[model samples]
Target chain A: GQQVMQIPQYQHVQEGEDFTTYCNSSTTLSNIQWYKQRPGGHPVFLIQLVKSGEVKKQKRLTFQFGEAKKNSSLHITATQTTDVGTYFCAGIMIYNQGGKLIFGQGTELSVKP
Target chain B: EAGVAQSPRYKIIEKRQSVAFWCNPISGHATLYWYQQILGQGPKLLIQFQNNGVVDDSQLPKDRFSAERLKGVDSTLKIQPAKLEDSAVYLCASSFQTGMAAFFGQGTRLTVV
Candidate 1:
């Protein structure tokens, strides 16, 4: 039973502070993706990492895929009220069908002004 | 571009009742996925369809849950004799292909009392 695990099930940060969430998979992954879900909204695709040790950035957000492809992380700098939501990391295992995406328990984030 | 679409934004039924949710994936997307997200948790994959074929459903609770993506287009998931634990948001997502980023729809939130 392969599984994706995320650390810090919850995070609270003051506006302008930075926050980070980590993800680890029980098995090697072919690729990893990051998604953001606003309160009461659907999960939206943020970014995807395919290459080993790949790193991508979007504005104040930074994403990294481990060299082994079994772990990933998402970091956001200078939190804002609009950033209040849950961050989820999903992975596709090397042996699984390409469409069988697995997700980790999200890390709920809250920002205080 | 239009995103994935789901119907009946919310539902509430007594335990043992049956319920079904529908979804239409983005135009031209070939992959569709169904996931269950309990409150405070991440979305868990229930099944995956590639075109009109079943690619993976290892995690789906077959005893009470079933889904179909007939015609390689819109899909539906049904749960019979639902239990209180079945209370969760049913999320439908689509992707252009395997190992690609997924676009999710506003999920159908189900409450089984």
Candidate 2:
């Protein structure tokens, strides 16, 4: 059994402010995926990070994985109203236990315009 | 390519009632997953299927919940004598393989009185 914990359960900021959410897993993960769920909408795939100490960026969002592969973070710069949603991190367990993916509770974000 | 599809966007039932949800994953995806998402929480994996075979059902409440992917394409999840805690969104996702990121469907929202 594995658990992934995410910090900052709720965040509210002005439209142009920056925001970041952190995730840590109880066990080392082989890979981690991020998803976003809008209000009243289903979750949407965001990105995936593999390889230790990896960093990836999309437009205004940046994703990073720790060297130990047990922690990750998502940072959004100059957020907009459209960025309001819940961000989730899912960690894939190692040892190939039939792809056991454990998900974090999520970070709910509200962008105030 | 079409995304994962689900039926009956919403449902409402009393406690101890039975209900079912349907999902149609992507055409070529080899892995399908069912997740339950409560309000303000991330999705939790209920079951996973690999080509009509049950790969994981560790988190599923077997006493009242069951799922099947007979043809490896469409799947159904059933809950008999559901409890009030079963009021949540049932989400379906599909991936090309066991280790990849997944694409999710809109999800079925269920409410129990």
Instruction: Give me the TM-scores of chain B across the candidates.
Output: 0.98, 0.98
Query: For residue A84, what is the lDDT in candidate 2?
Result: 96
Candidate 1 residue A95 C-alpha distance from true site, Å = 3.6
Whole-model lDDT for model 1 versus the true structure?
0.93
Error of 1 at B24 (Å): 0.7
What C-alpha lDDT do the candidate models reach, one value each? Answer: 0.93, 0.92
**Stretches of candidate 2 above 4 Å error?**
A95-97
Residue-wise lDDT of candidate 1 within B1-113, one digit each (tens)?
Answer: 99899998999999999999999999999999999998888999999999988888998999999999989999999999899999999999999997899999999999999
In candidate 2 chain B, what residue range of length 10 has the lowest lDDT sum? B49-58
Write one digit per residue (lDDT tens) for candidate 2, span B1-113: 99999988999999999999999999999999999999888899999888898888889999999999997899999999889999999999999988798999999999999
In order, what DockQ does each candidate have? 0.83, 0.74
Candidate 1 chain B lDDT trough over 10 residues, lowest sum: B50-59
How displaced is residue A48 in candidate 2, in Å?
0.6
